[model samples]
Target: MSRIHKFVKDLAETRKTPKEIKTMVDTAFEVNSISQSQIYRISALVMAGRTLQTRRARTEKEGPYRRLY
Candidate 1:
């Protein structure tokens, strides 16, 4: 991942207010964009995200399934 991505991902794994999160993005990108609002929205989603562990999709539709299978 890019440094920026890694930093955001790490932040997402923990807790932070909008101000601190904004500071992080500012330090990494060091520039403003027309899509600045979108960036903030994405950052908020990432910040409230679950564990960074990768998840795979399952096609089966069975009940009480277990990965042990």
Candidate 2:
């Protein structure tokens, strides 16, 4: 998972306010700002038990392994 994703997931799970989450994300990423909607969307996914995937994982190729009977 991306560090940013993990950070957001942690804070969201802990019930931190969305504003706090956004502030932390901006500081950690060294960005001028991040949109509140993005934070809300990510937090919703985290609360729903969805795992965040990094870019590499998103494009990684799968190996062919046949299942054993």
Candidate 3:
């Protein structure tokens, strides 16, 4: 993983606040600043132990079709 992603994951694992994480990430990656809102989004994904696109698919059956997880 990229250093920024690793750093953010570490901080999220420690239960750091979004503000704190944003500050640390910004300081660590001065050339590529990230917004606090983005930090919140990343931290939430990290804490959830999954990525945004990794959700289970809908399992409902439709007449002749069904969704798989």
* Candidate closest to the true structure, highest lDDT: 2
Residue-level lDDT of model 3, residues 1-69, one tens digit each, is 567766887888889998888878877788556666667877877787875344323222243365432
Q: Give stretches of model 2 more than 4 Å off.
A: 32-34, 53-69
lDDT tens digits by residue: candidate 1, 1-69: 455555665664566554665677787688642144543544555755532232112313333573531
Q: What is the TM-score of each candidate against the true structure?
A: 0.39, 0.58, 0.58
Q: Report RMSD (Å) for each prediction in the order shown.
A: 8.4, 8.0, 6.6
Off by over 4 Å in 1: 33-69
Every candidate's lDDT: 0.51, 0.72, 0.69
After aligning candidate 3 to the native by TM-score, how far in Å is the CA of 9 from where it should be? 1.3
Count residue pairs with overlapping backbones in model 3.
Answer: 0
List, residue by residue over 1-69, the lDDT tens digit for candidate 2. Answer: 567767888999998888999888888889755578868877876776765564235435443443221
Q: Which residue pairs clash in candidate 1?
A: none
Best by TM-score: 3
Report the backbone clash tally of model 1.
Answer: 0
